[model samples]
Target: MNERVNGLSETAVKLDRAGLDGMDRAPPQLDRLEREFQTFMREVDEAAAQLRLKAKPIWFGPVKADIDAESALLKDERRKDPPQQEADAKIIQPERLDPSQENGKFAAGSLKSMDADTGPVRAQPQPSGAPKMGEAEKAEGGSSDVFHRRLGPINLADNLQAGIRAVRRNLLVVMGFTLATNVLVLAIPVYLFQISDRVLTSRSTDTLVMLTILIAGAVILNAVLDAIRRFILMRTAVEVAAQLGAPILGAAARASLHSNGREYQTLGDLQQLRSFLVSGTLLSFLDAPLTPLFMLAVFLVHPDLGYIAVVAALLLLVIAFINQKMTASAFHEAGNFQSRANLHLDSMSRNSQIINALAMIPEAVKIWGQDTAGSLKAQVLAQDRNVISASVSKAVRMLAQVAMLGWGAYLSLEGQLTGGMVIAASIIAGRALAPVEGAIEGWHQFIHTRSAYERISVLLKSSPLNFERLKLPRPQGRLDVERLLFVPQGTKRVVLNGVSFTLAAGESLAVIGDSGAGKTTLGKMLVGSLLPTSGNVRLDLMDLRNWDQRQFGENIGYLPQDVQLFPGTIKANIGRMRDDASDEDIYKAARLADVHELISTFAQGYETMVAADGSPLSGGQKQRIALARAFFGNPRLVVLDEPNSNLDGSGDAALLRALSHAKREKITVITITQRPSLLNCVDKILLLSNGTVAMFGVREEVLKALAPLNATNGRPAVASQTPQVA
Candidate 1:
């Protein structure tokens, strides 16, 4: 190996020395390119490092060395870990509208978390089996129950009734104005026909002057009434829209948990229905309805020709019916395509950042483009049918008018119909056919609009969170879990099996566990966010199943893991309801949560609007605000899930101080967390294992049982107290 290397170096040196070789070192451009490539690689590595990955270890009992690999998404439920099996059932929809989960978190660094303003909404445990607070704690500070409004059923006649009322009032006020304009409009041709028959026949100027005045008056009259009609029509549309929007969302909010909790589809259908109301009545009114009114006014003046006009309308209707029936299926399909394409575009917009980041731009664009193209293609076909339909209808209308004109002329020549009558009849016949043309346009729009309304309605009627057979009085905050069976609400996984514990008023319990320990699930059940499949969460002497809905909501305050902040003034967000809260009270809560300083620094201070979950603030700042919102109600019990996850040391210290304050106030604080600092402040700890109580009792006593496993490589004898795990 050394001789061969020496020969290659020697050959290169000899060749260079002989001046046969061009260079001895790499080029400057190559060095620059190499440096640039390295920089790019560094960036890619940093970006890749930020990706989130969930993993679980598999250990063959007492096995020596464990192999590391990516954790697989749980498949074949029968073989999955119990926790994973439970989670699988809880997922709302595997095929969801939002595709962000397919890859992971937002590709645009970190997404700002959304915190819903719970405001005065308390999530007290249900009476069915949810734990309750004692009388002492309840008397100290109690929250208000959730208010549900009654939403009546939708009757088909409701809309038409509204329309009839509006139109009648409008017509009463405008009909006289319309009549004056109509008479003026009719007088022009009538005067001309009379002049040709009388004045021109007799060479007179009286009718000529009258004809001039009538045409000018007709224009003036229309200009005035048309303005009023336009405003009234617009007002009518607004009234209709307002009436439909209100009862929907409010009704959905009031629906019984058991009745429509599964009908999430109802809300989407209702939205579609409202859209139909907008396009069907308002747009079509101007497009087609006016034509019929004009036709009707003319027919009233000329019966001799109106009969011929009526015949023409019948022919037109026959043609229109044939055309509509033949193309109805295609138009319906087009409407559906447009709706789907619109939804597709919305999905694309939300995931644009991820698609662009991973060079999946073309794929995303392709999906959107396909839908758009299909929609456009359907529209073009529908447009063709419409045009053909319109042409056929128009031809028949013109034929009827021409035939009427000929019949009128023949009658006048025979002295059966007068000359003025012939002219008036012809005009009247054309006007009568106007409404038929309007129907075609109105019918199409009505279908699409109705479709939209139906979709929106479905969305509005979606089922609320279910809490069946839970009708007991509110708890007083005494929670008992006696040999309770743990059943995952979404999935059938057993997080806690035969677990037993008791939470008394004025006591704080800190539950510390690793991820997948079912800590969050238990917290949710306690706070009414979720219901247990089989376990009994008893309150005082009774089960939560028997609790009253309204009263239960007032007793407990819950802070979920994902905080949702509403977009509004800080004061509005924090105080929410109970606007009666004093400025000092809000500031105290803010200061406790450590968000007072952060919010006060904004331009508007507490009045400042928080856009998109307080984008102006950092994660810790937003979290502080959420914490403040949670404690605003001063309920009997507070259940917090990972409240300190994003807080810095300072923020965390402030949070602990606030929790200490809550304890001092004699509030029952149940915390789900993994933070060690929480262990020091809690009155006791509950250790959960395999959906069962691994350990429970005072913090000092329970910690002794977990000490053996918590011991380091060089620690003294650790465990002292041990509570047996079932």
Candidate 2:
């Protein structure tokens, strides 16, 4: 081993010293070998250059010594512990090599290359203790927390915070004006004191006139501030309502389709909150906080007066607490009953025709009466509690006034107080307790507002679909459903499972199913009206949830199982109730649905008025109008669910012609139906049963497959020209 190591070292040293010089001095064969070696060396140098291997100077002698020393160290370590082996028992130091220089150079070079590729190092994740930037901003800046929160996930505190933020500006104005108004109130008592002490005693006409003018000026100032404050609060309430009106209605409308609670209650909650904002009850609340200031003024009058005022204030507070404790639960129950009754009434009114026709009015009335009676009983109980507390509070207030008067007279007789001071002290003491008395009187209203706030809070917690998303250009009507599943809320039954399909642009497909087979639900999902529980429904390769709903709605048309027509003129209904819908667009849609001639039969033509739910218009007329509206704007994708349910022969023919025209225009159509007539126009068929696909293929193939089943059931198959599947 030592001889081999020495020989390698000698070879390396000889080559380094004499290789270039000896190349020319050698024989031809030796020269050829040396040149070939140099060529191979050059190739290696080029390969190393490509690999970015930088060469550093090193000595062979030190490397040899280090290897020998490392081997000796390992042997010694192994001999000391034969059971275990250590690969790095001792660090070998190369005396001729600078370890720091080589390691530092290589590390620095590698780091420079990586830094260029990856940029700067990223910071570590934030600690749990760190507050979110949005939360920090909300705390520092006065922004509505409710506005930030959605309707279903938030609590009452967040709602109150939002309400406070909404009226924050007006509240500041009101507080300042309230202070001014109450301060001006001081002018009245001061004037009374001066009148009795100075004007009455001295009999100075000029002083009396000056004092009267100053007091009148203060009264005018107080009235002006009060009016301004009231106006600001009123406007603020209107502004808040205006801002929240859309969100509240949006929530209620969405909730009505799914949520069990009274959907209309949200509207009432908004009304109650706005009324509270503008009501005298709110003003009294503002004044209640100034009760302490009035008591302090009374204290300045006399210690006896101050003590009486404190006792009166404390008594009113206790009475106020009793009033809330007694009436709150009753008020809450009454409100619940009232909302429930209202919901039942709304449902009844919408179905009044059926109720009256079936002679169900008596039974309906009995149920409504029960609800109303329950609500009335709760209201009466709450009022009774309120009246009792109010009577007791009034009695206590009267006794406090009488006691103050007696104390004042005694002090006056004892020569410790003047007549004017006695009068002033009594007045101030009453003023101190007045706000609390007012609050007790308005306790019922306060409770109602509190209830309204709570309901509104819950309504505001429901999060709407986020409309802020990447805007894509209009879709090409290419629909894709991938492994879709839907389970309705609060139900264990699945409506759809693993439903996967793709529909190309400009293709027509008919969805046919037995009753309760999720046909309507499928149509709704396709049109982006309802979301899938799992997987995805996409249009033009983009998820429908990510699409801007309003923008998507403009390009997509849907006629639901139950057709709805807004209260409007025939022209407006055909034009989708859009104010900006042109006459040409309206005429085109009406013509497309073949409703123009039927509409023309009316004396007023397009100007014919339609009642709510398209009342007074026949069912066929409403369905035709809805169909026209669905085709309005020439939507790229159209979904029709049971479109011909109420249509007559002429209406049916019109619907068929409309479908043909839509196909001609390359509109992708998905129609949910049970009729063979509509099936004749569709190119493909999808038959669903028990929430799974029974058969899906070209209309011909699906109809052919079902032929055998129909024959076995003793039912004739649909004519091949008008193929159908059941």
Candidate 3:
């Protein structure tokens, strides 16, 4: 027994290196004899035959060699203990081997059983003499999965908090530059005081030259600091945009998929935030609180002058507050009206051809005008209030200046104030009130931006998609819907209910139903474009949600009822905008769908530019090209809705050929069709009616049952072909 074990081990080693060198190799007949010892090898051969995998001579030889080596090991073990085999069989039960253990040599049957779980069984290669994947492998960039950007809980507060964090990251440097610029601005008032007091009183050329030089230097320093501060703010805005861009855009896109109209407007809010960051209006608000510094300087000059400055500042602030209170409601209404008008404009523009064909342009124009009118009226009312407050604020500011001069003249006569001191104090008072005036002027912009921020914050806080999802391998296209139900958001109406079916790999099912029968919704759920409200849609027993969407999407082919296309070249659309899509696969898909000749008719062939929604092509041309895209990469699962709606006799023939080819290639197909001619290509028929399954059965049984009913009664042919659910 020991001698036989040693000989078989040596034989296995020789077989592994058989093709490596030109050594005179022994005939593999010795290994073939070993194959007769194992019952598992015979079971595997039968399983492979059931799968219908054609065995090429070249491929079969290598497989036989491998089986031979495995059999040899088993034969040597059996020789060691003939009687131990029956007893050891209890210990070597296939059920005891973990399905996930790839190293289990006698667990081949476990591979087939792994499909009982919710995911497809995929074979992973274990490199000979290689260490197992671990933290070291992960650190070396071995993981292919990526973590998506997560935008935490959707809400206004969280959005604001995110913004605050970004700002605080560089707040210290920004603050330093801001304070320095403000301090340099003080030099202007000080220089003016010295020029009036020292240079003017002395009336000396040397004193004037020295004061002028000092003031010029201070002005240059202030300019430099102001530039640096502006640069910092701009850089901060860019960084904030970069950090939050992906998450915000992803949230918006996800919301849009669920028909959240407000989500589309979220992008506008992001723009507003970016604009506010770079705008000087926010900076003016920041500097407004520093106004008291100027007021204190005035007090140092003379108590009477200081009192006037404080009263003037308070009056301006009162007018500003009045402006805000009067215009807030108006501005909010105006924003809502503007949003509706924009939405209407977008819809009308997209459907302009239909409006013109129906001669409804005048009606559309009137409706649009009405929407715009409401927006305009609100704007005008807000503007009227703004103008009134602004007028009062400006008049008070001018009045304060004139009154200060008059009061100074009186004080100078009494020898309580100098002329230079009065001039300097008035300038300080005006500087202190400048921010108030600026705020009033920019109040409307601030209101619009604030409203945008609140709307966006809410969108950002709404639930986000799961990032860092498990990366499951490609499915073999077995589809299962377990009592699935789907109800759209904010609606009690159910789109689909209690829909259950099973499609084995490489089988075709035809879904036949009238309008509003939930056929479209079923197709969407199967392709993972929409989620079921309850129950599950699984591929290979695993729920679709559990599978990584990006990888799963690569194995799926979907054709929507509307036949939409993006703005790009013909080649790009067919390739689904994949950068790695080969020209061979693209051309092969085009040929399979019989669109190659049609595309060649165009001046640029594959490079021809396609308008959005494939608007540049005729209905038949669009459907054919879309079919070609669905066939791209020979995807495992293909779901086509109303595919032949626009196709002519020739196009329908081409579609039939494509379906036939897809079946031959072992692709699973679920096609929704209004025409009965398509039934010949499908093996099973599913009839849907009013969100429930009317019938589901083999194609022949359904057609035979329905034909007799149609012959006896005057019922519609399509309905007659459908029997009650069994």
Q: TM-score for all predictions? A: 0.61, 0.77, 0.77
Q: Where does model 2 exceed 4 Å of error?
A: 1-163, 723-725
Top model number, lDDT: 2
Alpha carbon deviation, residue 292, candidate 2 (Å) = 1.2
Best by TM-score: 3
RMSD of 2: 19.2
Tens digits of per-residue lDDT for model 2, 169-265: 7898899999999989888889999999999999999999999999999999999999999999999898778766666767677677666548657
Q: What is the lDDT of residue 485 in candidate 2?
A: 89
Considering TM-score, which of the candidate structures 1 and 3 is the better prediction for this target?
A: 3
Clashing pairs in 3: 118-541, 118-542, 153-461, 154-461, 154-462, 155-461
Worst 10 residues of 3 by lDDT: 53-62
Q: What is the per-residue lDDT of model 1 for residues 57-120, given as tens digits with 9 covering 90 to 100?
A: 1211221122231122123222524663453232223232123434443333223222233112
RMSD (Å) of each candidate, 1 decimal = 28.0, 19.2, 11.3
Question: Candidate 3 local accuracy as lDDT?
Answer: 0.74
Tens-digit per-residue lDDT, 1-726, candidate 3: 455456656766766677656245545544553763254456655665433222111101112234664466448546745674543242222332333543555333433223343333333444222222233222421222222212343233444567668777665676777767766777777777887888788888898788789878988998997788778788877876765566677667767778735467667777877788778776777668778888888889998888998999999898989999999999999888888887778778778878999999999888888889999999999989988888888888888888888898899899998788888888888877877877887787799888887776676667443433344434557787889899988999988999998787678999987789999999999998888999888776578887656656766789889887778988999998877777887898898777898899999899998987576788888888898899887677899999999999988898898898887766799999888778888989998988898888889877766665555676544443344221
* Span of 10 residues, lowest total lDDT, candidate 1: 52-61
